[model samples]
Target: MWFNWLTALTKGVLLMAIQIVTDSTVQLTAEELATLPITVVPLIVRIGNQEYFNDGQDITNTEILTHLINDTELPKTSQPSIGQFLEVFDRLGQNGDSVLCLSLTHFLSGTVNAARQAADMSATDVTVIDSLSIDRGLAFQVITAAKLAKNGAPLEAIIAAVDLHRSHTKIYVFLNTLENLIKGGRLSKAAGGIASLLNIKVMGEVVDGELQVAAKGRGKKFLNKQIDAVIDDIKAVSPAKVGLTHVDNLTTVSEISQRIKAALPETLVTIHEAGPVISTYTGIGALAIEYYTD
Candidate 1:
């Protein structure tokens, strides 16, 4: 059925079909993956001596959170191996299709580099894009590329559209604790300890592919005010979609979702649990909001 749709759309105009590929960091459910014309390569997550794939099926964000809470060692995530990328590329291009692979930000992960390296070695025609963002922010670009590809858009057109979506997207994360940051070496132990002693909650935003501290304060009220400010910022733009992702913080994410929905009722809104790869850095009680504007 999907092949028929592709054939009908590209019948006389295109030489070959375009295939979409992305890493597991993108915020998409198993059902969404099943229905969408896209392929995902899973990231590897290791907790202590155990290794799990961030494929949503083999491992879940909840299970990762449990280990994060109970285990002493911080979880570590690795990008899919070059061989993994080659496998997907070779399989997808078996029918002479062109593959477009999107990966999480280079600053956060080495996935894009690996994809590019694999593309060089594989016989298939493959293009790799560094998404420059993660979670739903990355999904905005990947899903847009998939939709355009499915509709028979040319490779250049799909890349252009994806870049446009990327420019229009913003991601903000609220960190509940600094323990992960310290353990992951994103923040110094001294700084994290000082912040923890003060009970500070940090707000960070993804900018130019790097996470930067945007704001900080103590308590829920400060976070609420910051969220309201973000809503106000959203009102200033023509928002297309808003996503809320949390690491074991449904209550807070739900409230944030409600606030966004109330402000932009017509815009598409979705909520997801952050995957293991993301949870490894964000830790428990973190909430991330991804905003895509038209």
Candidate 2:
């Protein structure tokens, strides 16, 4: 009788199913994904005539950075095709599980639209959300939904909370060099050269689905300003999670993470390596911080 009760409990837990789907830009670690019911769809990374997938499992940011440092050419990135999204959706939909797919901002990439197209083709109930942010900012929304889903929350509740989370979440990026932006034709060479010569760092945030400059300064002034902004936000809001991501710049990221934790001792801080899609724009030695309110 006791054995039967334990078996029944296991079956009951298994029935409470919801799946999380996110793109490679979410930048979540392997260990974290193991604990949460999340599946990742990789973006495409191109260098010269070669192409690679930003799948968190096989391709990593470390390898991508190595190529950037050694090669003269800057890497390029693209959103996953609709067919790629369909493959993932069909697999996850096999068990009739409701899926919540979070994607990079529509302004930055067409990943969200691809997800939506796949959702319409999916057999199971699928809700695709435009996170309106990238990197860990996107991860925060996915993490929240996965947690709610694991606790047996209904699909509607999960979607509502995730939608709100994406709006409230904020991401701040610090670029040590403007070489990539200039190379990509997003910034003029003259302006990038001027900024580089002056040792100025660029800081930006994604607002209204667009990248906007939030702050800029040189050396310590720049670092302090960004850190101060984070500290101020924590003081005003109920801090749920903080993420520090860097492009092969762990030392600086660690220092910043320490300062953030020192300010809010109870908050959980996750450090991730920025993947190819983000690195393609930020260039080498870029770092970013993302957080959401409780």
Candidate 3:
């Protein structure tokens, strides 16, 4: 009877746990965890969703797991450095639960690869997942996985959940400057030039685990209008559960967030700034919006 009551109570709660480290954060559901037989979670550095982090204090920013990448000059490692991920693994392993690290992408950063190396080096059992998308496109997956693991789901089942729900998410980004992409080597100079020539405001959507350009418009002034059009398109397909993120763009953040809340009050809306890592590529004053459909 006690066990049955406990199960019911756990099911009733969100069963979520979130942790913050220097420049990123990790959120998981304590109810369903992948690393089994070991009940303690420690020494783990939750990777930031490779999205933009905002720097302004207009909103309460505490407990969001933001890291400082503001003007921190570091070599672009096409992948997260092995040393970086290893530190977290070693710490998490201290508690006897094998380290389970999350990676933003195998697409942009070798962050997951780095985690593999770290796990090998430390000989700590590790599970690394390539969310295939950045920001909350990946974040929601992490949250879902955490919940499953806490619910006593095996690692493989948790990973399957991550992959399954990831496919349902949509991510969109509109950047004011392409230089950040070029500077971080995420985009080619030619593509940047072409986008600039037409004063292109990009509209990207996550499809099949990749961020595909949905449309390109000619000016910053047309951005809001363009986004609205995209929203209309999404609505035609289905209603969406969305998340909002920004990098030094308060006005756009507030404007779009307000507009979205008005249009879809039933959707869960969250706004966060790009932490230092993602900011290095998207630059400040950029915005990313993400959502999901059934």
The local distance difference test score of each candidate is 0.84, 0.79, 0.56
Better candidate by TM-score, 2 or 3: 2
Stretches of candidate 2 exceeding 4 Å from the true structure: 1-16, 185-199, 235-238
lDDT of 1 by residue, 1-294 (tens): 224445645566446789999999999766667766799999999877788888986888678888898988888878899999999999999989999999999987789999999999988999999989889999999888988787777788888888998898999988877768766765566545566557588888989888777888888888878888887888788498988999988998788778778877897889998888888888888988889988
Model 1 Cα shift for residue 18 (angstroms): 0.7
Off by over 4 Å in 1: 1-14, 186-199
Q: Model 2: which residue pairs collide?
A: none
Please provide TM-scores, in order, for all candidate models, with all chains considered together: 0.91, 0.85, 0.70
Models ranked on lDDT: 1, 2, 3
Winner on lDDT (2 vs 3): 2
Assess candidate 2 and give its TM-score to the true structure.
0.85
Q: Summarize candidate 3's per-residue lDDT along 1-294 as a digit string, tens digits.
A: 213334646678432222111113222223323443222211122223232223223212322223323334422324445776667667656555554455665656565676677778875567665677777676677666655555545456666666777777777888766665766666667656667455477765556655455667677767788777756755565445566778777777777667766777766666766644465566556788777676
Q: For candidate 2, lDDT tens digit of each residue in 1-294?
A: 212334645677555378899998886767779999999999998888888888754567778878888988788878899999998888888877878898988877889999999899888678888888888888888888888777767777777788788778888878876767767654566545566566588787778656666666788677667867776886577477888988888998898778777877888888988887788888888888888885
The best candidate in terms of TM-score: 1
Off by over 4 Å in 3: 1-80, 197-199, 206-212, 233-240
> With candidate 1 superimposed using the best TM-score fit, by how many Å does residue 138's alpha carbon deviate from the native?
0.2
